[model samples]
Target: MAQDKEFEIVREFEVDATPEEVWTAITEGTGGYLWPMQPPEPRVGGAAAFGSTVTAWDPPHHLTIRSEDVGFPTQSANQLEHTVEPRDGGRAWVRYVHSGIFTDDWDNQYDGASRHTDFYLHTLREYLVHFAPRPVAFATVDGPAASAVPEGLEPAARALGLTAETAVGERVTVRGPHGRPVEAVLDHRDAYFIGLRTDDALVRFFGRGHWGAPLGISVHDFAPDADAKENGAAWQEWLDGAYA
Candidate 1:
């Protein structure tokens, strides 16, 4: 199916945590550390991030939030829905759906949103695994191209400040334009994307255009005691410089 105005992004993920835990994270922590500012309250009629509103709230089973960017009035904004299903051994399966309308130019938006969806879900899993009880600070920054990963991923890894040259289960340190190094490990790296996991955050840096493929960076599970607002601002600044 071609990405069009009616494009709906659907993604599935398996979490090593229980449904109740996942539900609690989504409901109480306002979707669990995905926002730089306050998380949207989960109840219907509650305020949400990006100046959006909550449309649905079903504990541990389903949820939905709707919002729009004033910049594109006709774009219909975004209506995001999440569904959680219980599995054996205290595991859970989660699905995400993003529905929206657009008058024109959806290719880039769809691709970017799709990639972002993946990255955020990965963050969610990380929360369930490491930082479920603690509230968090999350940041995402996007911009123009800097450079592409070389024919191979080593150059890209190096550019990301990764010490390991191989994929999967390797150590990495991604220093954004800010020069502060985020020590992590290579979870996955390819021509299209790079996934790195740290004790406090999960960072996904893009490959094309110097890691500026619209859905740029996704950071989740930073230090719980750290100031969320300040951390978010710092990351945003680093992202801005990295893309510049």
Candidate 2:
């Protein structure tokens, strides 16, 4: 007989923002960073997105939410908890935990989710410190199927002038969709992920093919006139051109 296995990911970090600011960033769906969340009802036992329910809610301090038992044969019980505290020098310390159970393909699911948590939290800090108060237009696009191989991200990286030798904090200017110039700095880099930040936007690239999915890009455009749908389509065109 088969069995279910449990996994939990915990992360702690400091961000250069007050607890209230961090709280707004984490709980709002402003799309300034990471995935956008639907506004959850602000109380314990209230409804949340993704078939989850709010188990605990405390403003600027703590929160716990869990997924309902959806009866997916291979998985159940996804929970997330977050705690925030004020720190010296106008900063905040954050602790995050995500726990769940899986009945199959445990290793791949665990690795992907864990690494994604790190990247998402890093982006959260970036948003709180630099891009708060601006409404963001977010766009996410996946590369063509041809880009779904071991080196799935290399083409996009090369198009953006990134390489294996690229180091964090390195600055580069690349032409984005519609020949728009993106003057930015490399904020994060690793074997399977890349992040670029401009004065008005955060651009993230995921080499998901390393784990059996297509390479992808997400842009958080903070300009006052940004359009999410147009941005997504333009990036999709750019990606198609790159693979062509």
RMSD of each: 4.7, 1.7
The true-versus-predicted C-alpha distance at residue 76 of model 2, in Å, is 1.5
RMSD of 2: 1.7
Tens digits of per-residue lDDT, candidate 1, 104-182, equal 5577666756766775676677667866776566666553344433332334456566554466777755675457676
Can you tell me which runs of candidate 2 are displaced by over 4 Å? 70-74
How do the residues 147-218 of candidate 2 rate in per-residue lDDT, one tens digit apiece?
877788788888886677878998888778877778998999887888999988999999888778888999
Clashing pairs in 1: 147-210, 200-221
